[model samples]
Target: MSGARYWRHQDQRYNMAGNECGVCGSRFFPGKTMCPNCHRRSVGKMKKFYFNGNGKIITYTIIHEGSLQYRNQVPYLLAIIELEEGDKVLGQIVDCEASDLAMGKKVEMVFRKLGEQGKSGTIQYGYKFILK
Candidate 1:
């Protein structure tokens, strides 16, 4: 990502800030301009919401291979987390061992460096989760 774009989305990357539909109360991560559920009623009525960053692992995989940007993080855990608010998000699992994780294991989000954009470029920050 470019430096400008990376900084622009800091709230979302770090705080799980998305949008909630004022009409149907539906929530979305990477918040949409309109609610999928409420459609027309939700347009121009979406409100910002910050997630509490607590969730449970729905499923996960140990990635032993990755692109150059994530090469050092090979063998790391990638998971689908079901947030307490009912939104499922994908994030890296850090500070825990693969042997210690299981389906439905509790996890909480934490801010971490995603990667650098390029040589001497901005250091991207984002959320990852850890076993609770």
Candidate 2:
């Protein structure tokens, strides 16, 4: 990815930085301009929330087809994790085998290189999950 876009999302991708609605105290991953629960009433009442990255795998799948950037990494595991804060986030599952994955399995967040742009463009970093 381009350096501009990669850097722009570095915080959210690396730290699991999100926002909590002041009105309802509901937290969301990847941040949110407005709280889904409270709608516009919590527009400007959102507070920064950093997740501990402890969660459970709700569901998952192994992808044989991938994008150009991920062609070599086919059969990677993708999962939807439900955080302890009651928020769910979609991320890749790494450092483990597909046979080890199961519903409601515990997981922890990890920082990993998403990909790079040629030789000198940029190295993108993002969060992945692994069995805890």
Candidate 2 segments whose C-alpha is farther than 4 A from its true place: 1-14
Q: lDDT by residue for model 1 over 21-45, one digit each (tens)? A: 9998888876889988888888899
Error of 1 at 44 (Å): 0.6
Clash pairs detected, candidate 1: none
User: What TM-score do all the candidates reach, one by one?
Assistant: 0.85, 0.87
Give the total clashing residue pairs for model 1. Answer: 0
Query: Per-residue lDDT for 10 in model 1?
Result: 62
lDDT of 2 by residue, 4-123 (tens): 565766664347788899999999887899998899899899999888889999999999999897788998999999999869989899988999999999999888778887877687
Give all candidate RMSDs, comma-separated.
Answer: 3.2, 3.4
Q: Which candidate has the top score in TM-score?
A: 2
Candidate with maximal lDDT: 2
Error of 2 at 104 (Å): 0.7
